[model samples]
Target: MAHEKVNRTKFLFKIIFIIIIIITILSFSTEILFIPTSNNITTPITVLPPSFNSSEEKFLTYLPHSGFHNQHDAFINAIMLSYLTNRTLIMPPILTNYYPPWSTFHSLYNALNKSVIAKKYRKEHCYIKNDGNGENIDNFCDNNKYSKYDNFTMLNWDQLFDLSELKKHVKMVDRGYDFSLDNLISDFNVGENDTYLFIEDKRFEFEFFDNDNSTRQIHEDFEKKFLISDLIKIDKKLLHFASLFHINRIVLENQHNIEFRHLIHNTLIINNSKLLNIANGIIKKLGDKGNYIGLHIRIGDGIYIDEAEDNKILIFNELMNYLLESGLLRNSKKFFKYNLKECVSHNLPIIYLATDANDPRKNLYKFYKNIPCVFTLMDFSKDLENFGNIPSDFDEDTNLKSFYVPIVDLLVTAYGNFFIGTPKSTFSMAAVEINNLYHGKNALVALP
Candidate 1:
């Protein structure tokens, strides 16, 4: 009888233990469910600005007005967030439905291809209107196909930003010098908001003017009449609040310069644990046992200002040498720089992603000969299959949104936006900013 009683007691304890374990699992599942559910719940936006009592609070204004490329949106958002406490982002009015032109798409494909040479690749092959510009000029001429539509025109920088709807929200002040950096800062400060947003067409006010949609022609004519340094000077001056680069503006040309260095020093860093985890996950997936480094090289004509005469091969050599000497590449404590030699020696792999494929001039293998890397070109293009089903067309006046999941993930994971591209690209700048934010520091080193 005593033995039976002891067995019953043991059975009762087992049941209790099982119940407790089940309860713990249920609790954990509920917590996990709540997190994602809360993320999906959208907060209602209140348009009113926060009430302020201080009169000394100066507003910092950010002007990101032009709507040329979809990549510019990231830069626009970065500036808005950077100066969030004392700033407001005044978006330019949306213009016509715009998509990237054939030339631009062609350039993107070429850049991606060269970046990951000898890798598998594919892109969305769609029949966009070939209105006889650049490569399509011959196609249109051969068939006498210029007269598809008389009103089908490209959107100008100024035309892209109508601002009629936003006029009521903004008080217009004539900056005496017309888009001068100093004038932009003073006019937008309404005494309440510390950072105000005032934007205009830099090309029209300071760079070039175009009444017709002949920007390429206007750029050529303007270059003869002006200097790129003049625009660079204005950019240097305006680095205080934010400079929204459109039309291929993101790059590291001026990264080593004083002004950009100063900008980097002033910003704060916010690290995202999630981003770090994602990066670590990628490294493990690639079977990276030891050293890893990022080699960011951009190809295609669009990446350059005007395909400057410098041989890209020489540029690649210079960049590689810089990387070899940099501490990030030399030191194995925190970072392990991987190059062609190191990849061969250590059997390290590379994760290369590009925007284009059909370019001959880019020397892909010469720089990354022995490096093993992952290429998402094929898989990435596959996801874009259903993009055409969307009701909206790519609009030049407004920004066109693209989903580059693999590239974005790689960029974010590596914390590598600083060394990504040219100065005239918002895409590169935003990438750097995002990487910086992910790494939890404003001043990030893109070693080469």
Candidate 2:
């Protein structure tokens, strides 16, 4: 009887131990599953959405009113700002108003082959003309070749936010003749309720002897309140406010956000089949003859107003020297059976020149005419006809077609083996960026 009682007590102890272990496992499993749900449920109450409907989200919209490169800059800044704010981004149309002939806005799809915003955000998040209620004014979506954001609503910057509150939060900063980088960094402090920060373009304005000492002093006093040196410096702060409701106008003062720049470049897809075919045709044409050198000669409008001849010669010589030193034209005998001068006269090994000169034959073309293999958009004039009614001369006054010409030129330049572009030209910068991304070549900048 005593041995049986001992055996019974041992069995009871084993059952008790098993029950405790099962309880412990269940408790741990419940925590692992329920903790995340609890956090998600609490998030909405703690963090307010930046829109009228609590469920609807607000986004960053960029109004690009400048030229191609200026618009390109705005696009880059908008992407970074959107990432930092954790909000959807509204892609701006390529503003062609800078050129009088093409005075209408073109969709991002028309300008680029792919929609970077669509790739990154949900269908409802990104707002483009196709995504909103606006009519397709330019017929960019006639073929249904690109992505559409029809569900997204278009809201102007002023319409989305309280301008009075925005003005109060924005500390007007003025940095006269000399832009103080130090003062710009110290002025901005992110507040809990501060949803957005607007940095006026005039804050970083500096020109040659444009303002008086009295005006400069007043600007300096204003800087004491708030200031920002450039877009790069505030990257961290922007990232911090990204999760919250905040809109920031990127300070445009010669700063390159390389990380975001590369992201934008990689995301852009050239969706226009017509442009793609033209670009491919140029590549195939040059592929038959050895590698080609792409040159961007920017000589339109005010470019020639000051030291025109000198600038032209300087750029021309720079391109020639680069070709010679880089051994791109080292085997003259194989490509062209003549001396260097004769080779240039014959246009040997192909030199693809992309210029804005009204008459290529009259301007730099005269210098490169002797070269055995020099080609331009005029060479593929027939191919351009497939798109629509383009100007015979590819002139700036071809209405909507004016925008297409430069974009095609940009793609051709990017596809080349070697590229040399003029300094401070956004068109060249964009071409170079694409070249670097696609061809893995470092494009040379023609120093003047």
Which whole-number lDDT from 0 to 100 does residue 333 have in model 1? Answer: 33
Off by over 4 Å in 1: 1-292, 302-311, 322-353, 357-363, 370-420, 443-448
Please give the RMSD to the true structure for each candidate, in Å: 21.0, 15.8
Encode model 2's per-residue lDDT on 164-227: one tens digit a residue: 3212211111111111222222333323332243433332332211112213232321222222
Model 1 residue 159 distance off true place after TM-score fit, in angstroms: 24
TM-score of each: 0.36, 0.50
lDDT of 1 by residue, 1-448 (tens): 9999999999999999999999999988765542211111121111333322223222332333322334234333333222222223333222222222322222433332232221111112213443345654543221244232211222222222233332222212222212243344445444323332323323322222111222333232122322233322232212232333322222223322323323432342223333334444444443432333333334555645254334345445554564556532332432234433444455433343333334322445544342233232332343334333212122222222232233334443344322333344444444555555545655334421
Error of 2 at 16 (Å): 43
Against the unseen true structure, what C-alpha lDDT does each candidate score?
0.34, 0.46
lDDT of 2 at 320: 67
